[model samples]
Target: MDTLTTTKPLATYVVRHADDNLVLGQRLSEYISWAPELEEDLAIANLALDHIGVAHHLYDYAAEVEDDGRDADGFAFLRDERQFTNVQLVERPNTDFAHIMARQFFVDAYQVPLWDALARSADERLAGIAAKAAKEARYHLRHSRMWVLRLGDGTEESHRRMQAAIDELWRFTGELFEADDLTDELAAAGIGVDPATLEAPWRRTVLATLAEATLDEPHETVMRTGGRRGLHTEALGHLLAEMQFLQRAYPGLEW
Candidate 1:
């Protein structure tokens, strides 16, 4: 790792963070009218909005770093699938309530620590964004943790579904901590936090939550990769097709 002498790593780092938030936010939005309960629908919508808000701020900063004329909307709606660097976890489909909760739980666990560390970044703009995002991440973590408990310890069917969700999604979790040249450079420069550093604390929190929920932790298995390298699962293609449709069909269309 070395100090970042160029803005490339910084912009890429910010873009990766933005991609994670935006993709997960979009997935959460799919539950707007489909949540099991009306109150739950509102809650999920608000959470999705929080994530999108974080993405907007990060994208705005990234645009400035790249010295590009593109704005937040451009980054959000114009990028092709191969340009996104979000982890494979967030791009997965929300198969069910249990699956959604499991995904959120894993992500928020990582995000809380990530944002906390980023709040101390040498880059002031990034620090500010992380400070605000850290607050939202805390709330998101709490919400998802409660759901994991409720579903994991509830009725037999609920318990089964929660376990299944955990098992299915566990493989994707490892990619959250994978480091690359961009992260390595930024982290050494104190402009970004090394994601690998967050793993131990994340595991502690997640394991405790699972224990309280009476859920068995899934065994470590073959891990998924390549999202950071601009490769993605099939789900992301479908997601981008729907999400970028309006913008792609009518470029720069404004309300």
Candidate 2:
């Protein structure tokens, strides 16, 4: 039960989720000054901070599990694209406000339940991190759900755009629930939540929200994946270039 001395599997399991938050945090940060309203800009900024905060905690825990001298910053800034294990969904470009909301909604919907489940993880440290993260994810869900409803049920043009955004991102949702070997092993040990078990409730929660928003769910076809194994879209490379620039350029520079 002493996770710090655990093998790489535990560290990998924890950091994979950290990668999701770190990647999405960086994505949301890109919208910093550009959101439509002043209050909304501040909201997005706060959300970005929340995500990055969670990422740091998870990364900190992962580093401890690895029993390496590497810290959170090393995980955040030193890893190359292929080394990242975040899902592809969070890495998609924020094309527009509707797109942003759609992406946020899908991710928030998933994370709220994910954190809730993780809060009870057999790993006490991860459970503590999840307990804190669950609070932020609920707030994030409210923010995204509000915008999704407002846009999807408002003007005809807004409805079209929101629907388009939903369609564009739907394929990525499947990957969020797919359970693989790492998850299987961890779940059996009670050290992690099996995402496969989370999918049904996630569907109910998401579909209910979409119905309330008067939006049609996109039919599923292919599910985009591979981020767990370090395969990502081109966007991640560009994102890493910008996000890692300071650390990469400065090497060991301190503030």
Global local distance difference test of model 1: 0.92
User: Model 1, stretches more than 4 Å misplaced?
Assistant: 1-7
- Per-candidate clash tally: 0, 0
Worst 10 residues of 1 by lDDT: 1-10
Please, what is the whole-model Cα lDDT of each candidate in the order they appear? 0.92, 0.90
Highest lDDT among the candidates is held by which one? 1
TM-score of each: 0.96, 0.96
Model 2 CA deviation exceeding 4 Å by range: 1-7
Distance from true position, residue 50, model 1, in Å?
A: 0.3
Between which residue pairs do clashes occur in model 1? none
- What TM-score number comes out for model 1? 0.96
